[model samples]
Target: MSEATADVRDAQLAERKRVAAATVDTHRDALIALSHRIHENPELGFEEHQASAWAAEYLQNEGFAVELGVGKLPTAFRAELRTGPAGGPTIAILAEYDALAGLGHACGHNVICTSALGAAVAAARALDGLPARIVCIGTPAEETGGGKIILIENGLFDDVDAAMMVHPGTEHLMVRGALACITLTVRFHGKSAHAAGAPERGVNALDALVTMYNSIGLLRQHVKDDVRIHGIFTKAGDAPNVVPHLTEAVYYVRARSHTYVREVLEKVVACADAGARATGCTMEYRTDRMYRERRNNHAMAALYQQNLESFGEHASQPPTHGGVGSSDIGNVSLVCPTIHPYVAMAPLGTAGHSPEFREAARGEAGDRALVLAAKCMAMTVVDLAADPSRLAAAKAEFAAAQQAEAAE
Candidate 1:
């Protein structure tokens, strides 16, 4: 409050930063090795058994109470270092280790998980003056399934004062938009028949699927500018001479807000229904949990940007073009004061979810970005720990954001 208190706080923050930097410096090699190991052994969402075990063990060796298989997710883990008893300020360092389906680590989740681990370990060492609980959450299935959504439903972030994580990307970005998404699989069933002899008896399931796909393509133009609709044929007729009894397609509907996504999704599903009705076939559809859009906390994001600037690498505004994708972290940001910023790991134009991005995820640039991200995150943790009021401001912002969403 007073100048003397401000001076004391500044001195404490400086000391914390020095210790935090030193801690990350001491474990640089190990962190990189961990990141590369995870990259090499890529696993899909909800199936990161080895990666989760390795991360939990690393935090365990650091003296954090490790618990694997939390929130009904087999690969999810919660490791914590507590300074005192209950009711202490709790900060969460999120770790995402799941890789893409074909492109291993294309999104650089290995870097994300290790950066969180490094920050947790580094910040835990400098809690002498600032007493708080530092938690490292091993969240799986960010690439496919919504593991963070599952964890949140199970109260994974009940005590979290704030949450933060850094993702490696083509540019250093302070904050970016993540669209709300719905992924679904639609299947059409029909009666099969011999194409050459009795084709008239066939229901033509493949025709139904093709019609639905085309209808979706046409529906995209009618949706809003921010809406995105895409689908791929996962299954079709098996043989040319035999009519298809079953055909399947997977579709993804995305928009900037969950409400808008639902609205667009209704029309998208109607297209499929029309295809089925026209083809005299029955359609069945299934979807996983919906991913909400990110609610970036301005106060916390500003703090993270300041910390990143401390490393001599300035973070710039997010790209104006290049429509944003989706992530499970969006779900977390909706519930907590969170920041999912980015540090550069690849070149200026490397496209994510591609082979080039996958290769660059394990290169020298990724390693350097990993260390810088950890340091920045650790410093930001110190900022929140030394001055709890900042975290309070972040929470205030989060509450207001939630209120605005509720009103909408």
Candidate 2:
């Protein structure tokens, strides 16, 4: 492209970004109301019926073609708005609405989902003959169910050019990685007998569970630094006096990479098998869907950070080590160019999934973060839609990352 034409295109893109930011400001009140409403009504994974419906309704009102129960998930939905004709590049803005058990909105998903809604509507309004399609996907059950992972299997992201979402955190960060994770449930069955009178005839299932737990504790020492294995006893025993016939436990295994996590998971399960063999108790186990590690597209993240800084909200230096968790968005990232940045919502050091974080999600800081994140994300979408070169760079980066993973 000629320098003068490039300059003109840049100017046009700047104007669209301004319009998108203004559009976000225009819907500030409605967006806040939606965030507050979802905050007030706390729902668990796969059960965010009210939250999902409210989000879908709002998008429908904004002229997005809304579809509820997407990917065969009851609380999942997809809303689409095309700024131009068909065959244009598609950008997906993902929304997660599941609340933590016992603690409501502690993860600031209220901000996550509402910000996405605002960004989609604002971007759609700002586009001027841009050949792009903006899609807002209501991904439910981030707290438990792997909704995005299922969506990927359902081919929801097959046509997507890029995906972006902002999570509410203690500080703004353009790149935060998540561990790949999987859940395991184990049950042990043994013969019940009187503890005091006929203890010899009884096979203690609790002993087997305890043996497995201890074995895992030892296994943890041999694993990599990023590997995390934790579990809780759901059914240890009915009573302390009686010989327990059944015991069950649930565990979460996580690692920096999916392949390594699977390798570690096998070792962890072998411990359980050893426990069963040693205690003469029959054992059975099952694992839930895997949540892949995040692949943050640096090209896209730089654009998001640039847009975020334009609002005078600079992101903190990216963390070098330690602070990481798993999310289903990682699965989406593996399929297309994706960025999951963080917008500050609470003071630094405030623990996520806690009561303090829950309150912050509905407080003034939370509201500010929601609006600002929406504006930033909307402007970032403008960057992708207006400049083909920017999108090309992001796609190139994503392709390289995929190729590297495949070679590994």
Candidate 3:
């Protein structure tokens, strides 16, 4: 690049940094308040009307053109801001605000939503002379249905060049990938009768459930180390004196990749079927509408890592063995360049979905994560906007990974 062009780019970067730094205090307070509000309200997936509306309104106030109800989901929306020429690359900042069942913000989604919002606002204000389009997509139902998968199917991310989101975990760093997973419900039905009077005439559905659980436990030893099969009995016998007529369970089957997840899910279903056959009870199983697996976008992840480093934070190195849980964002990686990095909000070993993590979501540590995540995300957006080669590289990596997965 010519010296003149380099100088201009440097000037733009400096100006963006200045604007971001100047507004940090104001944005910080807004983010903290937003996080607390969402944490207190805590709605479940696909039903986060208040969370979605508040995010849209906040961005609209910050000069973004907000579009409510992007897909069939009532709580899903998109906010867009454009700068410079129209031909610039479009970078997407993803926001998720859904809460866990019964735990409110235990998974720290409250932090994720506010952080993404703060980042987008900073990006919008700083992109005065940059050649890029900024888009903040409000995706619902990360805890239940894969909202991003639905949005992708609806062609929401078709034209977007790259996407990024930060998740609050036990540590502050990027997660290279997440496990692919499928949720399923299994039901068994049998004839009910008085246990002491006509035990022979009644088929016990609870026995079928116990048999299924045992079968899965035995099957686990044969699967790959990366695979996980876990379930909970949602329904069982009501009273010991009566033979239960019906029973049900919910299961989550996970694998390192989509193909493996599909394979393991089939085996799990077979186990459930065997249990039903052994117990002489009719059984039915249904998989949830969405399935997602691990997503490792190295190029985009590295870019975000570098941006984080620029703000005095370092990305965590991948472990030599073992992997984290699954996420719907895994599905998004299959379609486009995407990064789901982890920003530390709680201390190490503070597990997600627990009461401790939920408490941490509102404390000082959570507030720090919110600010750091926002800065890193905003800076990464600037990086993507200022450099075209990086975007090309990210897209190339994404295509290669998708092709490799398809071939496998």
Query: Which candidate leads the pack in lDDT?
Result: 2
| Rank ordering of all candidates by TM-score, starting from the highest | 2, 1, 3
- Model 1 whole-model lDDT (C-alpha atoms): 0.89
lDDT of each: 0.89, 0.93, 0.85
Tens digit of lDDT per residue, candidate 2, span 171-270? Answer: 9999988999999999999989999999999999999999999999889789999999999999998987889999999999999999999999999899
Which window of 10 residues has the lowest lDDT sum in candidate 1? 82-91
- Can you tell me which runs of candidate 3 are displaced by over 4 Å? 2-11
TM-scores of all predicted structures: 0.96, 0.98, 0.93
Candidate 3 least-lDDT 10 residues: 17-26
Q: Write the per-residue lDDT of candidate 1 for residues 258-328, one digit (tens) a residue.
A: 99999988887888898899999999998879999988888988988887777788787777755599988
Which portions of model 2 miss their true places by more than 4 Å? none
Clashing pairs in 3: 172-344, 178-294, 180-293
Best by TM-score: 2
- Which residue pairs overlap in candidate 1's backbone? none
